[model samples]
Target: MAGLRVDFGLLLEPLGFIKVLEWIFSIFVFATCGSFQGETTLVVSCKGVVNKTVTAAFAYPFRLNTVAFSAPDPEGCGGAWTDIYLVGNFSSSAQFFVTLAVLVFLYCIAALGVYIGYKHVYQQNSKFPLTDLAITVITAFLWMVGTFAWAKALANIKMATGASMIPGIETCKAPGITCRLASVTSMKTLNVSVVFGLLNMILWAGNIWFIYKDTNLFNKSNIISQSPAMYSARRI
Candidate 1:
């Protein structure tokens, strides 16, 4: 039988509090992309006293929109009003999809870890069950998987948007309206949230599993007194 050498000096109190907070944070980030939804200007052109503006709106008030505008250069409008056109719009679905996948994975694992922690702490059963250990291990595995997915997503976005510069797209003339696309490939704020939240969740799951496995062994050894001696023990 495996047993934890309990040190009366060591406190096991509030075993599940940190996990609960991590779970809540992960869920909030997964469900909301509030910062990503807004109007963003991508490209601009200035020529022949003309200026053009391109804007991209994301997760907007429903139905993303991109608009282009061309106006005579404020300084000097002449020579056929060199009209310059700019183009910009919400990033491709591929970008958003990858992000969403990572967020979902983190959310699920964090929530599970928090729940398990709460159960283990409140119940305070000397012999934690195998089911509890299994749950913790599974959640930890998921956090690892989420981390890999997040890396892939970041790589894909970098390749697709490449420093926010449009590939093969030529710059617009100062006076003419030339179309250019702006890249909205990454959300730095959300990325931080995902990374930190996953790290905390994964660690929490590992801790629970470590404790649970030891407890299970103790139970098997009959070291834990689950019931009162009068009812559960046989007198020799």
Candidate 2:
């Protein structure tokens, strides 16, 4: 059997290099959003008790309404306190964003393999380039939609878990009781994910032109441009 030939030089080309970038950005998008775990603290001070801390932990998918934390011990607080829950249901948007990133990552890996190993076959077959162009366009659109939705969801998450949550807590309304947010997890990485998402969107959208150039339509257009008679006839 003949050995499989690999073209390392393709890695230097626009198609291969951009696919590598897409693969890397996809990893960032998923890792930052999928493996994340965080918590917010509510510090409660009562008339006769030391400040009691209540912590609500949440993670990826961000179904804030489903996450609840126990209130400070009622005996210590000198009044009954109910459990507290974070607000909002943002799982749909978060899940959609993460799932799309993962799919894009897989596609990039497969595309790079084809570029390196079977580039000759891909070039000779017009169908391959046409299919690639179609997929690239769809993926670009998905990145735009998913990234925007996820960004909006992230903002809502910040509001639900931050100081804005204090007013909604019943315990904070009692006389002589004061409640404030002590801390919340930093979303710096998630912010970076959004940035990467935007970059991926732009990269994929730009790549569409390059892929289009590989298709028969681009060649036909070029041929027509080179022949003024053909171009004039076509315009007629």
Candidate 3:
């Protein structure tokens, strides 16, 4: 009689799809700036907050009240009297890039761990190390989503200050201003971050399970060490 053959494709399909999803989402995250629309809506709809109201106040007496201004206010405006710097609210392209870079690095490590675990199981034609598998998958998901959040936050800043479409809008015209100047406008990012944090917690839980197995079960038991006997026992 012919022996049965296992379908490795069935087992590996999901992992491959997840990897592809990561790549697609990464391009969107990195390129789209997270699609953040500016707070012009809020500042316009809400009372008491108009053009010059959202100022970027710098250290000691330097302050740029609006994007229209080319220089800071006169209050001891610091000597030099050189080039003027405009101040405007803009998105966080640099921060988004940095955060996304870190996220990608972490996920690459997680993916490598998963690949190693899968290889170990397949080489012996044995069951996968479920704990390791879960940990790596969960870590990848969290890191991916977190990177998305940071990207969107920066995109939002771009949206708000009308910098999402740069060059058309003057760059560095806004002085001493970094991306994301308002908190009310970042609620979407905050929600995404919360979900990402929860996923991270789940990843940590999986790591704990792995530690428990290594410390209390793997070291003391002869499960894998006597695999042939164990398999025979299962047949009877």
Which model scores highest in lDDT? 2
Number of the candidate with higher lDDT, 1 or 3: 1
Stretches off by above 4 angstroms in model 3 are 1-12, 34-98, 101-236
Candidate 1 residue-wise lDDT, 1-236, digit = tens: 23333232212333344444545555554444334443334454445422344543444212222332233245423443332222333244324433543554565464444344344442355434455455566656655565555445545433334334344334343335344555454567546645654664566565674446446565655654655564655653
User: Superposing all C-alpha atoms, what RMSD in Å does each candidate have to the true structure?
Assistant: 10.0, 3.1, 12.0
Candidate 1 clashes: the total is 15
How accurate locally, in lDDT, is each candidate? 0.45, 0.88, 0.39
Q: Model 3 lDDT vs. the true structure?
A: 0.39
Quote model 2's TM-score. Answer: 0.91
> What lDDT is reached at residue 212 by model 1?
64
Per-residue lDDT of 206 in model 2: 91
Quote the positional error of residue 154 for candidate 3 in Å: 4.1
Q: Which wins on lDDT, candidate 1 or candidate 2?
A: 2
Q: What is the lDDT of residue 133 in candidate 1?
A: 56
Question: Which has the better TM-score: candidate 1, or candidate 3?
Answer: 1
lDDT per residue, candidate 3, 66-170, as tens digits? 323223224212332223233433334334443553465466455445444444443333234445445455655655555555445444443434434223333
Q: Better model by lDDT, 2 or 3? A: 2
